[model samples]
Target: MKVSAEIAGFMKRLGHEFAQPELLVRALTHSSVVSPTRPDNQRLEFLGDRVLGLVMAEALFAADAKASEGQLAPRFNALVRGETCAAVARQIDLGQVLKLGRSEMMSGGRRKEAVLADAMEAVLAAVYLDAGYAKAQAVVLKLWGARLDGVAEDARDAKTALQEWAQANGMPPPVYDETDRSGPDHAPIFHVTVRLADGRSAEARGQGARRSIEQAAAQSLLAQLEALA
Candidate 1:
């Protein structure tokens, strides 16, 4: 009951409210929220994933009318990915509004990338179901439109984007060296340091090799750029 008010307030910021409020409730419920007959947002998450993809594709295409498919695909992938969505989801404070079982809630499940990202998809699907495709598109665009504004070949990945920006501006591409790795090989936490050619550096962590390198590169490049400015 009270969940409705919270969600309504959230959707207002998100620029759309649900016509059928139950869909929004289910969207905010992780799989941990279960009952004798009803399930959680898993199915809606599945549907929402497709909806998000479709909407993102449309956004990518419309925004980049001149980009080749090969070029557009990766940029599209990066923009709509789990990490990006989870980042955006976290920005919206979705975790605060999510409904989860006590065990999951206590274990930081709401902030988990998979949960946050999937919940975003579920919310997208809920919007779609409530008001159909166009309104859903409007909601998604409002959230991600600025990101789509100037996509290009150089804009493939943010990590890549930062690297290219550095290189073009007479800075060396940041170097990502593994500082340490922990946990099992199958799921290791990598500590990577990003060193600039100009004797500056920074570090960041990521769950896997490519991500670690990218994040480290981003941190170093961002720091250098900020300092220069």
Candidate 2:
């Protein structure tokens, strides 16, 4: 099959040309578009996740020689999280190349954070398979860019931070509840509220799974608390 000009342009932005061009096609295909002959990116995404984790771990280790594993752990989590991956995907316009089924397209799958993030991971695996680990590393490092530079300080887990703040004030731990779930199953939006013991609370919306939405709600509450302080 011929690679479309759009895919070609995506390859240019991704900074890696595939030796096995079909892999690029597979990486861009969403599970929603399954067929007997066409494989989706799920397998590739699984492999890419591992590759991303290893790269981030090594980078964090070298960047901060004095940081304890406790410190590095959050940073590592921040780097490989779906939100971060989606952010990087947005930066590179990865959304422009995603291949979704009709139903997914109608639901705005291209713009969904979870979809984009998974596609980004699959793309990384495509690069790894087409070239090698070195090339894949180069693509990831270049794409991640400044995120790696500021990861240490920005990596503070918002949920952890907010919990500590509550405990310091002798309040019970925050409670998070999923207030609502909307959209299709493949691309749900979670609305979560984080409430402190004293009833001060805030809600936030996030795209993807419930855990990330909970984290986002905690972050939102923390920001409001800081503003009041």
Candidate 3:
């Protein structure tokens, strides 16, 4: 099948040439643009999620033969989370080739973390279907290169760490409040504040998802507390 220049460029960036080019096209199509004849990437996303999880789990297990399951779980979560997937998508400029609907495009769907992450997973499924598990594993490892090495540090949940710090200092757990929200419904920005019993507080603003924003706020508060120590 003939592929467009844009898709060709994207293939170069992705480091995988699709044998079934239509798979890649479907992978790039979002739910907003779905029809009876033209399907979306949701099914691909589901399958790709499992493929990604298996790859990461196997890689993590092999990388650290001595680490406990507890130690590895958070690391796996850190590597496969939407935020991390979005980061990988951004690295490959995946958003540039996405086929979004008019409404989604108007709402900045290309830049949205959730959209990018889901599309990234679908692309992985496409690659898997086009080639096989070996090619898909190689692509994932290459794209997630340094992240695998730094998974240990990244696995530390800032909110949990902050709460532990507060408990150790004889203070109550910190409180997180959603101070404000703005932007369109499809892509809203969240402002969150985290405060401890001792009045130490920090605020942060983030886009895409509120939970991620809350985590960012917690991380900010933790940083401030650590700096004063």
Best by TM-score: 3
Q: After superposition, how far is residue 12 of candidate 3 from its true place, in Å?
A: 1.0
State every prediction's TM-score relative to the real structure. Answer: 0.72, 0.85, 0.90
Candidate 2 clash pair list: none
To one decimal, what is the Cα RMSD in angstroms of model 2 from the true structure? 3.0
lDDT of 3 by residue, 74-180 (tens): 89989999999999999999999999999899889999889999999999999999999999999999999799987764486888888889999999999999899
Best by lDDT: 3
Writing each residue's lDDT as its tens digit, candidate 2 over 11-105 gives 89999877789999999999999899999999999999999988888888998899988889989988898989998998989888888899899
- lDDT values, one for every candidate: 0.78, 0.89, 0.91
**lDDT per residue as tens, model 1, 135-173:** 988988888776667555644665776777768879877
Off by over 4 Å in 3: 164-173, 182-189, 227-229
Judged by whole-model lDDT over C-alpha atoms, candidate 1 comes out at: 0.78
Clashes of 3: 0
Model 3, residue pairs in steric clash: none
The lDDT of model 2 is 0.89
lDDT of 3 at 180: 95
